[model samples]
Target: MASFPPNRATTLKAAFRACDVGPLVGADIERYYVDLSNVRNTEAIESLNTRLDFLEPAEFCSILFTGHRGCGKSTELRKIQKRWEVEYKVIYIEADAEIDILDAEYTDLYLVIIKKVADELNKLNLKFDAQLLHNFETWFKEITQETEQTVERSVSISASAEAGGQIPFISKLLGKIQAQIKGADKQKQTIRQLLQKDIGRLQADINLLLGDAFVKLKQKYPEYEKGFLIIFDNLDRVPPNVANHLFFDYSEQLQSLHCTIVLTAPISVVYSEKNLSNAFDTPNIVPMVNIYKLERQRGDLEYNDVGIKAVASLIEQRVDIDAVFESPQDLLELVKASGGHVRQLMRITAKAFLTAATRKHNKVTTDDVTYAIKQEQFNFERSIPTELYSELAKVCLTKDVPKDENGWLMLFSLWVFEYNGKTRWNYINPTVRQSDAFQEALQSITANP
Candidate 1:
């Protein structure tokens, strides 16, 4: 029997650790590797292909893509962008890049929109028309001045010499000015009306800029026939209040815009009662692709088996697993325990390979997998707060928690565990269900007075 050289296994394990989760592993590994890409699912690819076909002409459609974080929503979006780039002018921006917009006053929202549009246009290597650029600058200046006046009228302060001396000139002047402006109710009302007027003008300028871009593209490429598409991801990452205003209050303005806007927002933002007024209803307006449906299908053997095969293949690329495992079953068990979460399985298997390699083991048995599982569990627990464990326990024992009014929302949050590049809320982790630690905690809770 061929044996791995002394420390050669350790070196191999370390090398595997450095490999990025992105990119294709070898062909054999590609078959078994849990693909976080949408290409992994036939259904998803077909659905997206159909959506792309519909959007090819680009008639101002608003789409909302929602999924559990890391369930490959972003990856799918990028794939669509890549596929559509040939036909449509595609521009992608992440909403979280503008974190300052969380506390954005109404005018600040318009500024963010303009900035994103300008950035995307620049990225596409498109030159802005000098006429439109001048109009945007004039509109932006007016909006900024109007916003400053509104802020001055909303906040009041009693300026003191001691505090004034320490404050920046801008802050001090704004503070004293705000105090004077806010003292009169009529002035405050006037400021609000002026701000609203400026916002309307800003919106008009943005519409004009988009119209100009579209017309210029059509004129430049008379033979080329596709509209521009701007995709915004991580809109949900914005503050809830701002997200509500952007989607709800400005829905009509967004819908009227010449370009197709695709937004990836959190499901909660669309569903929240406080934010629901005139917001696009969850089912009706936005085209949503459900990602969870791809994990399991009709009476098929749980895809967990396929997931295991995939991870094993990926591991083979970096580790000489033949010498470590007597049979593939041992490796499969490790994958099973990982609950199909690709990242977790890779991390656990990598750690176990390192552990076994250091021990000079030629065959990693079930014991090695067992050790790795425990190590992974410990790592997971350390990262999560103890409160989460308690909440999870509540979920596991009852299988159903109280809904509506008073309930532990976090329990519902954990219902879906992201595993093996899929989101699974229905499948329970068998190891977790059977573990003594988990059971003991449940028993202790049950027995308590």
Candidate 2:
């Protein structure tokens, strides 16, 4: 709905080339970033930055960063890494990239964190003190009955004899154990149980390593004024059971680490029975970019012109909407249907582009948009049970999500979207309301009422 820059793509091929359904990373951040902090009403990463960088006594605490899966949480975290690289030796741990997320346990995370910190520092030629390394390695050996020889048998690290130091042996040992955890091998559970037997010792050892690493880094690297910052991304992909085990059951253990840690969580965690306030500070939530205007009456939400324009800018930054769509209104239609979800908008736009090409259209038409949205609506309809349709209609009417399991499931599934105003509220996904099941359900409820 808003005019875009002139240097955008002109051909359908160019439009297709511009589509990226994943989060922006690397150089793309500088190219395609749209600042929706004003619209989402939360400066998710900046708040953490303020706490760590600006606060008087240097607040070092475990942070909970959460949002819907594709609402640009990773992109924001990358922004933090890039923004504070000089001040913090940031170690970003991507759970999916590094671990078996579905079955991950707290012990597995402990292994992953220590291994990564060691590996990262080793790359900088900054090793933990040799005595500390020997102490930790000897403890691991006795606890798990795992010696350096047995560890090398599982993972193919070179002979430790050539690496003449305790740090290399310690690094190799951690690598082997973490590999066992990541590979889900026979030793995985054993390692977990052994670690859990003395989990406090494990925590103590890690904090010792962190403390030494902090001192070593601060001493060697004067530019690193804030020490180490470890961010755990995509931890949200873990199932609810595992999330509860990590965040609720073992929260204090997680917080006990003497470093600034940010853990991404599923958006549903906020509504869980266990209050996050009991464990960590208030979670820094990156809410959906509100496509609707502020101060609207309940159940009568209208699109905000500025919000719509911002959503369009997200697309325009990637593809030339003028080149892709037959009319500006066609782009607007997709934007409204996106419910301000970044990945959803890209999905719809890409699908419409492909559908247009198949239909022999030079540019994306309203017909293509309708087909894409209907396809998405069909997906949401199938995933939702018939019984929930009435409940979804009620959420649409009241702009509130129930704080029980059902509501958490709905938000997790994207059947409902959370938006920020004076307070947060829920509404049905824009395309979901287009389905016949939902329409019928809403009409039935209205008529009966």
Candidate 3:
């Protein structure tokens, strides 16, 4: 049998050869291929499809699509948007890109929406009022003191001069510009109030402009059934404070629009704040598609087998797996350790493949998979704060559940424990709960409270 020397290079080469026996793909594997044959959670997809179907008949339906990070939420959103575009005039925007909305300001929020709407118009080669563009220029100057005029700055020019006063490009450009500005400083605070007034005026102007356009379009194409649908994806990426304002404070205005609005947000955003629940109380307003419930079993061979097959299918589209792995089982081991996180699975696979390729191994084996996992764990540790683990340890040791709602929610959301064959919010690990420090902390908190 071939053996490795005690040296690091020799050991690495041996591991690489082992990995080649049945190479594992890492989390860094390309997502496009993995996501191509996306196994749609039938229930989640059906609910969303039902909403889209309803919206197609000139009805408004708002949905809050919630899932953990890397759980394919964005991919599903894109799929829905693409499918609805033929029937409904779809405009998709990312809320995280709107920086100014975090301060609980409705004006900045409106600006972002308007700007996104204008961008859609521009893409469709539509035109709108020159006067509105000029108004936007003046409003832009008043809000943002920048004097330089670029394609972005001349939104009014694009909206009015390029066509008739029918396109709302200026409004959309203003939203983009407003979203770029950060925090409610004294200067921005003053500008914000002024901008709010302009926003009201701008909204009125847009309602008239868009209303006229809708009428004209309907007159021209009597067969067109739906009005428009604007999807705001990645609202969860926004600061929670800002997200609350966008979803809660201005919900009515959003609903009242002649178009349908769909928002994708973290599940926590809806449940974390009482105000959020109160503001968005309409049961039909935001139908939720819980994607978190679809998590696959960790360390299950059958589960890993399916995931590996998915991963292999993805990798095969970009590179030759036969040249990478001796057999499929090599890849299966890596998938088993990945916990079904697509990104993590890809990353592990990629690293293992790279390691094997460097060592000129014909097939990856178990040893290489182990090495790749170690490498991934090392890289992951570097990105995460060292203190976070200590905090987690403290929580685990104390068995002291947090009193604050946010803190408790954070613990659950962060996946601090696994219980009853599913991830839940209880500290059931005996070893962790048995820690003296944990017990003491729990006593102290109980006594203090």
Q: What does candidate 1 score on TM?
A: 0.60
Itemize residue pairs with steric clashes in candidate 2.
Answer: none
lDDT of 2 by residue, 1-449 (tens): 12223345677666765666766777777877888866777666678777767632234788899988888898889988898897888999989987888788877777778887887787687989888877888998899888877876765434444444344666678777777777756778888888889987888888898888888888888788678888999998887667777888888888888778889998887878789778788888888889886443456478988889988888887776666788999899999999999889878887888889888999999999999898888888789999999999888887888877788788888888888657888888998888889889889988886
lDDT of each: 0.50, 0.81, 0.51
Q: At residue 255, give the lDDT of candidate 3.
A: 54
Which scores higher on lDDT, 2 or 3? 2
TM-scores for the candidates: 0.60, 0.91, 0.63
Superposed on all Cα atoms, the candidates' RMSDs to the truth, in angstroms, are: 11.0, 3.9, 9.7
Q: How many backbone clashes does candidate 2 have?
A: 0
**Backbone clash tally (model 3):** 44
CA displacement after TM-score superposition, residue 371 of candidate 1 (Å) = 5.8
Q: Write out the backbone clash pairs for model 1.
A: 32-310, 33-310, 324-364, 340-419, 340-420, 341-419, 341-420, 342-420
Model 2 scores what on Cα lDDT? 0.81
Q: Once superposed on the true structure, which residue ranges of model 3 sit more than 4 Å away at CA?
A: 1-41, 56-58, 96-106, 129-176, 179-190, 197-203, 220-224, 241-256, 270-278, 281-320, 358-368, 379-449
The candidate that achieves the highest lDDT relative to the unseen native structure: 2
In candidate 2 the C-alpha lDDT for residue 262 amounts to 86
Would you list the rank order by TM-score, best first? 2, 3, 1
